[model samples]
Target: MAFRCQRDSYAREFTTSVVACCPAELQTDAGGKKEVLRGFHVVLEDTLLFPEGGGQPDDRGTINDIPVLRVTRRGAQADHFTQTPLSPGSQVQVQVDWERRFDHMQQHSGQHLITAVADHLFGLKTTSWELGRLRSIIELDSPSVTAEQVAAIEQSVNEKIRNRLPVTVRELSLDDPEVEQVRGRGLPDDHAGPIRVITIEGVDSNMCCGTHVSNLSDLQVIKILGTEKGKKNKTNLMFLAGNRVLKWMERSHGTEKALTTLLKCGAEEHVEAVKKLQNSIKLLQKEEPSLLQFHSLTSTWISCLFPLSRKEGDSEFMNIIANEIGSEETLLLLTVGDEKGAGLFLLSGPAEAVETLGPRVAEILEGKGAGKKGRFQGKATKMSRRAEVQALLQDYVSTQSAEE
Candidate 1:
């Protein structure tokens, strides 16, 4: 079936009626693919269901109680594929889901708003648009938009929406003077027949094929999410409109509330609280050496009080003490804790010592680590005994040093 562009000539308020219905029999050819022969027919004096074209999704709704699964253009005719076949000459009422229809209208109209704004404000023409999940994006003939320019354009679009300008759709022949008056040079000159011109009153006028709102106010809001570089000399802009903007705000505020509670701060104080927490962490890191040195003495004196077989909780303290000692000689420090397991640090007299003994110690501890120059650090997953690690380190140091 050949594709036909219908929105250009069709009015926004129209409905389709079923013309014929019959059991569509399937026939297979050489390829064995089933092809339905004249399944059903729909004839509408006019239709509001915009046929799939211009990168827009088709309108969805039930017709004569049968769901319209898909809509396609067949030459000058618009074909509506229904779930169930309808009787021939049945006067079925078509109902378009206005909410869904209006959303597409809002987004399509918003594209015009932004595109027109871009041309007027920056002399850049919008080359294309792709309506997306989070936001609709428009591609401009430029590579980038200055932050200030984007802000100004966004402000202008919202202002237009706020003004509630009447959006008038005019159908004119190719030679219409009104077409020449507001025609965008970028529009193809070869486009034949009547061109649908959407005029935003005194704000904008351009040739468009997609469905649009009757008024600017229908958009409610126009938000510029962001911009990115597209193809050569093209910039893509992401934006949202109406319900999408409201939904985004709701989700964003909910996230902020969750973050505020987790940070233990009020909504307004969240940023400051996060900054303070980061600063406190930095201060503790700087004071770790002195603090660990003091704690090491307590651990040594209370060695009997503590277990000869350390648990996971004690591994962190052991690592701190090892780091505090900061030895120049080859040092192997190991600490075992119940919950956290064991931590091991191997420091070498020279870079060569680590290369020789590091992998061997890792294998003994059932761990993994790699280092160069002078030090190797890693954690053993679950070491049951401190003596096991101590004996392995001693054996490696004695034998390996002798060989060197």
Candidate 2:
């Protein structure tokens, strides 16, 4: 049995009797917190609100002035989940959200047209699709779709729309031979009643259960945003239809105006200006390594003075020094920030010696750090005690030499 919405997509309001109403709990995100909402599952004798199915979402509507949060199909019945309960056998006025319903109709029917055109023009079969909030996507089985193919597909689709192709729906029994001719993945396991097939006159026919526009011209316009790489061996084609295209244009124009003001250039020069700015940034990054260099200490170990701002911490400079002068044969006791007061220190040397002496150095320097393998580092509040930390490391080196 077809629901009222499925039979007539334009139906906005209707009166129906509640066949059953049962308690249902819905978990919803309220102010970013997940909370369970108590509601009721209402089964109407006939409904104008479409239940969620296919690649489309459920329709928003009201039953007796109470909001219907969700609708789901169970077997052949459409279950309207609402916060307020209606009495069984009581007649209630139901009203569909026409704005939301019409937007969905445009996108749903638009998908059929695109899918058909893509399949006929190119052998790209739509494995799956999503009707996202702002845009819709059709995932094709191929790994990539070139710009040329997308342009041709878009052109052909719009041409058919201009031709004003009639979009019609028909129901056939499960055993009907015509069912074999309609394109579909296969019927759902719980599917009941006759199978529904949507056809665009002289274009293509597909077996789908979602509500759609009555004609191709009702789509207004379709804008193929671009293609994105999907899961391995799949390509997702993103697009906007009807009012969504206008919404996207409005947003894009606002962004363009903002960019023009920030860049001090016209829209035509924005790309070149951005490219030049990016190149300047890349050139600056190339000179960053010159910030540190190896200075020979009395023990022939490497030392470096950090001249960068305090906000730019010493970790990257210290790593660059360590990488340049391998720590196996020499020790690196590096300090950053003020020379006589608070600062940061890093002590890198032989693993065994560092593991044994790193913490003691941190203690003298009045900071904490952990070490693995051959590196120990931490902040130092008492950088005035740097002499003591140096003495400790020198003593360890002297003792090791004496033993050798």
Candidate 3:
């Protein structure tokens, strides 16, 4: 049996009797937090809320004022997941998310038009397609799609939209001869009831079970954004239809304006200005090695930590500075840069002192390390707190001296 949603794509509200309702759990990750939601799996005699299928997401709506979290097709039935349960045989009003539903209709119908036009003009078949939240992709069974082909296909689809082509849907039996004329991959294994076919007046016809707009004018507009290389020598065509195109344009224009302000140049010069800044950065990077230096902190400790403020050097550079200083009786603290920002640190000296103080110094620097014998080495962060490490070593040395 055809659901109310599939029968009338424009219908947003309907009253139906609950066939059954059972305890259910829905796992959700809203706002990046994952949790299992306790809910009811509601089965209505008929539903206007389309389930997740045909590459389109499920419709979000309300059943008797309770938010419908998800909908899935179970054979011939549409299962609506809701937080509250409805009594079996009880009447309830269902409402669909019209904005979301209409957006999907535009994209799905637009795909039909594009696939038809492409096949008619270039014999390029659409292997698959995705109706993404931001944009849609149609994967064509071809190595690459040229700019000229994209422009042509885009022009043709939009022209048909302007022409106000009438889109009609009808259901037929599996053995119906007319079914062979429509374009389709095949019916799903779990598909029940008659096969639904969508046809564009004087354009093309295809078998699809998803909801769609009744007229091409409802699509508003179609924009082929660009193409991407797909796996296995296929070309994925990315596009936007209806409101998505407007949203994309708004975001792109805002980005251009922001770039113009940041670069202090006109829109056209923004590219050159950014390139020049990149070149300047490269030159600075080349001069970074000369910043390294070695020195000692007080007579109580020898410090090889340097290029103290240099951000360009890494741990290997710090190791070289320590090598230059050689072994010594006094405590040694070597760092390529400050841990508060980034870099590496190494501490070496008396065996017992190194063992006791290594972990403490690592904690102070906000980094982890392992040490044994007379040497403690590890990557460190927040090196700006190196003063605390020095103070700790000085106090330990003073304590030992007083004991002796």
Candidate 4:
């Protein structure tokens, strides 16, 4: 516990004896799902690697140049999962990735400062937090946090960081009287033995298991990007600290520059420019429907009077045809379909001929329809029957013409 509470954020290199090495231990798939990993897990006698716990990710490093693929804790043991197993009796040099470890320290410590300040200033409690790879998040108990409020909190957080307050780690016995007075959510239910708490001098103290920098100055800076609605009236604040803030700013500026060039406008004018472009597109779409039509061509069916077999059209097209062929002994069969699904069918001609053959043609085509006067229209699920229906219509017309 004393070694862990030391001020150093990085243990560059250390020699440790392997307590045990399992050739094959049943572990779960690393894909964050429930599946057997077949054989995985390594236990070292003593180590400085911090496994994934307390919302802070695991420390990734090398054990004698062999990559520590993953690290997870089972009870108090920090299991160093690796592909190359070191024998139990062998001693190997271990190295923790200081860059990654230090980043997490910044994020974890930044969260502590922000949470404490938020509670003190606005009465908003920190219910939960996440140390994300790209940016960290702190979930507040309030349902809403306005931009101005967040700005206020952000300003205070940086002010505390600029103060360069000392961050101290302490180990207190379970019976310690000061443990209850610590400003935090509370201790874990199963927590036992000495409690590990992080105290920011003159600011806040939190019961935490994650590593942190020795001073608030090590945080460099904390920037609150935005807020999102969380479960049960919670507002999650997205933020970045240390070098991450600079990297995020770099990326955002690059994107804005590109958008300005492409939109042919200043960064401040991008929104209005985009809105105008969208309105132009909407107007073009409104004009396209009237231009698409199924022009008619004559065929050998019925003097092509009503012109059988016209191109596909919508209900408006059918209306246009109906109005144009008024009171004429015209024969027109209209069919329309798209992407080869069900089709629409229409046959209009002399009242006697249409009334006589429309229903029969529909039955032959395996379609559903009704005829009134000299027009018939219906829906056909099996459009492949179009040819057969046409042939039957021609045959019926021939038979009727012969009798007449």
All candidates' lDDT scores? Answer: 0.65, 0.84, 0.83, 0.75
For every model shown, what is its TM-score relative to the native structure?
0.60, 0.70, 0.70, 0.67
Q: Write candidate 3's Cα lDDT for 49-68 as tens digits.
A: 99988778889999988999
Candidate 4 segments exceeding 4 Å error: 2-7, 24-39, 189-192, 290-404
Model 1 regions lying over 4 Å from their true place: 1-16, 20-45, 184-193, 269-404
For model 3, what is the alpha-carbon lDDT of residue 376?
81
> Which structure is stronger by TM-score: 1 or 3?
3
Q: How do the candidates rank by lDDT, highest first?
A: 2, 3, 4, 1
Top-lDDT candidate index = 2
Order of models, best TM-score first: 3, 2, 4, 1
RMSD of each: 14.3, 14.3, 13.4, 15.0
Global lDDT of model 3:
0.83
For model 3, the stretches where C-alpha displacement exceeds 4 angstroms are 30-33, 287-404
Runs of candidate 2 exceeding 4 Å displacement: 30-32, 282-404
Residue pairs with backbone atoms closer than 3 Å in model 3 (clashes): 338-383, 339-381, 339-382, 339-383, 340-382, 340-383
TM-score pick, better of 1 and 2: 2
